[model samples]
Target: MKAAALLFIICVHLVSGGSHSLQYFYTGVTRGINFPEFTDVGLVDGEQFVYYDSNTRRYVPKVDWIKNNIEPEYWTRVTQIAQGHEANFKANVGIAMQRFNQSGGIHTFQSMYGCEWDDETGATDGYEQYGYDGADFISLDLKSTSYVAPVPQAVITKQKKDGVAAEFMKNYLTQICVDWLKKYVQYGKSSLERKVPPQVSLLQTDPSSPVVCHATGFYPDKVMISWQKDGQDLHEDVDVGETLSNHDGTFQKRAELKVTPVERKKNQFTCLVEHKSGDPIHMILTEEKIRTNSAGNNLPVIIAGLVVAALVLIAVVVMVVKRRSGIHTAHDET
Candidate 1:
């Protein structure tokens, strides 16, 4: 019974068409921000937020914030904060730039407090004012300068770019979904997971004319194709083609479409390929030439053959007439 069950499971996997090799899809916003600098504060304060995935041992953006915001503007600001922290620390290191740049390991300092001008007494007083309380404050005359190791600027720059890019992508994707929902009015949530690649091809009758549009993928349970002209859905003068299976293990699918050259040239035609997953892939074919021609089409070849035969016959007739008229003998003798 156990063996039979194992065999059944294997059969089920084969029949069901197991998942495609796992490929990570990373989409997000990346932004760059200027770091702050400060002088004379004497106290160095630096902070960095390192993101990591405990389960996958990979670094990925925090997803919760992204879904909730659904806007690029918000994520752009978050990236600024993360980058600002790194820049602030670099300024604190001051003269330690060389050492920090060389190796960014931990560096410690002992006597960091220094004797400087008092806020109340000004530069005349040697005592350093330590507190904001009315008159009660501690005073230390001994002055020493210390540098806290700076944050690695390279690291900061990379993080800032990545964060911003990830956020931007997220927002872009969300907007796509919103637009699709507004237009379709029937697709349910969770439709974004089944996205397939877009299709571009030549129209059937006119091989020289190219048709660019989106079609449903191979294995998707449901799919839709739409064309837009001047930002409006085009219903007339557009022919929707059939979908074909890839027969591959994955869910890849394709569909054909036909549109007139006028529509294609106007840039008014867009092929929107949508699956249950998310935003559809939009494709525009600008070129008029078709991508493929049927091998059986023989009109051009037949015309060329007829022209060659006519030229050969004309040459033969001229040669015979010259020979019969004795012109061939005269020409040869000369």
Candidate 2:
């Protein structure tokens, strides 16, 4: 049972699809002077999957994406893996708890099984440790037989010479999880290539302002936005800005190029954006194309002022004409 649980822990780490499938197996056994002693097993599937909290005795999932989109068979296999570890892990913890009580030590026994792998770099590493309190008493590395000190070189050398480490890795880690990973990749294809086409715009704070090429709402993170002079890419007077996140999950970034008042009259600057999903987006920067900061404000303000002035002028002319007519009527009557 120990061997099986250890192999499953290694297999979970070995599974990668453009990202690591980091899973942690945990067990804890605690007993107070008067309280009852109990042990439980836990399994945590990172980020996209579920976590079995031994304390709660329930499986809590991070997202429902797997259940909604993933095939039933795939999830069933994952459930089996979790169930198989439950009893074995509890039994292992019970043994540790018995040992601690026999020694008359008041301590908690905890063990963690972890797998760390880097998908881009193709690095696979994991460790299993059992200890009381916070210090580990037993440690094993699945990668190699180079055991640390206090674990004698003779023992490690003997294990290495016997090829124990190599056999364990091959038989358990490599072969067990191949079928599951194949289906996981298919179900997670959208996550691997999820992208939003960039929305590009050429803008200026004012008519004579520096031209900025902006791109927003893109995914998979990295993008290139640049200022082009005539047909070539401009390097001088270019301020390449950093990409920033939007309120939504996408990202936004802009690159600015200083444009003089004289340069604004010419149709020489163009903004170019490159992203994975679509063809390069291009926008020619011209005086007419540059959007001023107060472009929409000026027209409404001017129109309102003219209407108010016309109303005041009309009122004054009517008052003066009425006064003249009253004077002429009084003169005629006299």
Candidate 3:
């Protein structure tokens, strides 16, 4: 269950597309506590399809396509490889603990490797990087084809390894990984290529709050949100937040623009949203157009109230007709 939750967080770091990707993440913890000492996950196009852990000691498929389409031997080979990586990561974490002169606190060593392919342009890219205690430690520089260690603590380990691993990584990322990505994409093409458009809203809390342009429920995870003033684009004072995943596999993003009423009155303000699912959207920021969370400003409640009033009016009309028909029948009888 934790592995499934991690997939959503990993979406923010992926190379998104019309393209496809194959990524593997491994982590080793200093102390197991309630969690596994070592864990591994594999994702294609931001969706987790396979998972492994020190406790499980097995490579297991998370989706139907793998069980239906992939051979059993693939899991065996992957499990063996992950076991080897688990041992190395554990030892590396201990060594790091010693080097840092820490005796008992929890620490982590993490590694991520992946390849991305642009189906539209036939372009490709690959990456391999490692982190220690949640900060950059070492990475294979694809451009220089050498390892980079950002801090002094990692320099010793960086000096021990040569260019052999980098060369291997280059080959795997460019050729082997991309081939696997294409296959996985084919296996799930029905879902991998489908598009769902975004639902966009412009929101404000009060007269002094920043105006927010929120877009949610978009698929493919690629979008552009920006602010425009009059006929020109406003590049400054706009805070663009990270793209986040929804529980149902869609994506959302927010861009906030801080503007004074004087500035808003002098120029036309607009939020422009672009996504692959549909045509671009331009929402002009007028005071009357922005949805608010102030007292008595809930849109849903307002709409519901209108619906209730209409229903009450219809019920009254029906009752009046019934009463009038009964009176007419009595008078005719008399």
Candidate 4:
């Protein structure tokens, strides 16, 4: 029992001594002072001692383990690097915003980490800032900020605004041109023989006088005027005028056709404007003097009218027959 008591006291002494060693080293290292070896050489002041294990690549904490683990210099370096990167990122975003605002293009600014100020509306915005924990790092606030600016002065002051708008407009015009060139020019060239198609106006007009056809829309230069009669293409009977481009870059086309009075009365003529895209659109004109033939064209309506007339006639005949029979029966009873 005495031996066991002696052993227990020794164990307690060793534990206490080990704890004291760790505490002294943790305190000194955190104060930027050198750590001392765990050996019993009386605590030396101002002497740098390496307490790191070279084989294990681990440092022994001389101060509180949590407090001394992160060096102040390490955090300082990290802060400096982050600030520099943030500056560059903000500068690029600012330049892009300035360009888009001046040119009337769409561009919006958003904060990935810090607060952003809207120069237009004077609003402040904040986004999530990223941070590093002891073991891992993560990004916050993944959403885009909501400050949009008008086109900047730099974009407007440059002579290229018209050119840029034109370039943007070109996409729409190019599509039209490609379709037109394919249908009219390409298809025309592929035909066995080139012929100037006639222009017929289907709208009501006097055959003895010239009928005027006007064109209006975005593309004026790409329009062709022609006339057709009884589904056959005509050439000499139609006169097409030059297409004129307007100040807004749109076009206007006109054509005139003179037909015989008999042709107008027959309602056999149609006016066709062939677009560059090979899509032919038309307008029909009829003369007021022409009597419309409803004979075979209104078969269902004629049948319905005949059926109603027959039903009314049958009702009248039945009423007369019943009246006569009632008189004969009454005379027989008297």
Candidate 5:
């Protein structure tokens, strides 16, 4: 029993100290730091204007709303503001890394300053977060800002001595979040409840094969994509994909089903999409339906082709008649 107890204590000691050794092993080599060089901020009424610098290459006008509505003068001012913010953020990050003695491989640092006011609740909240190497090292909320535990003891000690936590909260609230809110409120009170329905498409690499249903351009992010057979949900042979963000701040996802020949013949398979938008969208699966939709989309092209052919035939007939009439006139004159 005494030997067992000694073994258990030794295990505990190793487990406790082993984690620190592992962390040091992983971050032993010093790597240069690279911070984000751009800023993106926006406001929304019924319309949203998400402004970012075009030079930053992070902003792509994939949504028609941004492409059509962004004013040139507004873009100019936003670009300048983004540049300034980037400079200030990088400078602060540099100072923090130096303070932490970060001479190690690939450490990431992040800072977010946000403010929101709710008209219904009459609550105004501001938040700030500082993360190092993807862990929340310090945080600032509406009430207080403090260093989180589980960080390096050296870091915690330095932060406490320098009063960094309190200063960060003050500067972020007064200098950053407040200023952003003042500008954002002017755009209007556009709640995030607005839902933009996804644009869905069904794809099959081969005829009479497995079907893939793709959904894109949805907003607010909560959505359900399913494969159904004869009004019943399917489990087996169904592969549900993850929802990912689009460049324009929208979301997209896909679901695939490997269907049997018998199910394909019955024409009862469908891809159902559920979103915050009212009713579910149904995309029927069958070769006949695919051909019908294809034909309907091609109707305009078919009509245009027929019209062009008829015009060419008429032109040729007119030219032949004119040539014959000229030959007859020449023959009579001769």
Candidate 6:
């Protein structure tokens, strides 16, 4: 939250592989914010593939494989669909602002659509969620085949725009999204499947601050980062972070352990990073190895640390539709 505006937890898209995932993210912002009116990003297996923004007005591939392999017609179709969604999203944001009786501030309307597929078993499932001003706006209930809004303001939308969004999402997640995901996996097989070892480091801003285990440049987005004290796994006072993508499509993660000088001297602390790309890296926590810096803002928490407890995967928090608002607010699907 930032000064009367909802500061979104700007997430780098998370996708899956093997067992692959496809994620489509769309964001529409209030006018006068100078941000893009609409932006869309698509990711497969945690790698960003495509991007589109109001300025470009065209769907562009973010990766070489996607650019070289995908047909122009596919891009054209995606652009057209995204254009339509942009129009509707902008309008919806405006209407929503009016309904909320809001004025003179930057507001955002965001949507995340994700799909998960297990290649071996062909098992497929996914989730679709939307948010307004940092709060869960709406979500889908595949079992009942209806839309649900956890918030009071969105209830009107749930009633009037019920099955249409759910049906489209269901079809998209099962058919269109999954089909594209398979192609993405096929196109980027070499890079997606390749393993790269992580560069591990021990960091600390000051002795009073927590000891940080920073792992960088790992591939496949799957890696284990943990701390060991005296040859035993140490779980307490540790703040382990989720994996995040680097600009080059590699992944990085960190875990923090709080300790005092006395504890550090008495115990042998080691940071371990295990990745499929290579052997596990062990960095023993020694005074000489712990790099100290005063800059805490260097590592910013860009995305929400939302964890999903489900058979599928991580999902954005969902809101229930409050009572119906008389007028049906049309939320467009991208």
Best by lDDT: 6
Model 2 / residue 7 / CA error / Å = 45
Candidate 3 segments exceeding 4 Å error? 1-18, 30-37, 53-63, 76-80, 203-209, 261-267, 286-334
User: Candidate 6's residue-wise lDDT over 56-88, tens digit each?
Assistant: 889888889888887788777777766766787
Clashing pairs in 6: 149-319, 149-320, 149-321, 150-319, 150-320, 150-321, 151-320, 152-322, 155-322
lDDT of 2 at 315: 7
lDDT by residue for model 4 over 1-334, one digit each (tens)? 1111111110000111101110001100011112221111000011111222212323332323222434666444433433333333234334434443443322221111112222234343322211111111111221321111222322332233233323322332233322322222222222212222323223223335566555544231345677777777677667875443233223445566677767767857666787644457776656542222332233244224433322111100000001111001000000
Order of the predicted models by TM-score, top scorer first: 6, 3, 5, 2, 1, 4
Using TM-score as the measure, name the better of candidate 5 and candidate 6: 6
Greater TM-score among 3 and 4 belongs to 3
lDDT for model 2, please: 0.45
Please provide, for model 1 over 1-334, each residue's C-alpha lDDT reduced to its tens digit, 9 standing for 90 to 100: 1111111100000011111110111001111212112111111000001122112322323323223434555334434432332233233233233423533422211111111221233221111111100111121222221111123432332233233333332332234323322222122213322334444332333544434342323334245676666567777756653332222212222334455556556666555666545666666554443343463444344334433322111100000001111000000000
| Candidate 2 ranges beyond 4 A from true positions | 1-188, 297-334
Clashing residue pairs for model 2: none
CA lDDT, every prediction?
A: 0.28, 0.45, 0.67, 0.30, 0.44, 0.69
Name the better of 1 and 3 by TM-score. Answer: 3
TM-score of each: 0.25, 0.38, 0.72, 0.25, 0.46, 0.83
Best by TM-score: 6
What is the descending lDDT order? 6, 3, 2, 5, 4, 1
- 73-99: candidate 2 lDDT, tens digit per residue: 644554444444444444544454454
Candidate 5 structure, TM-score to reference: 0.46
Candidate 2 vs 6: which has more TM-score: 6
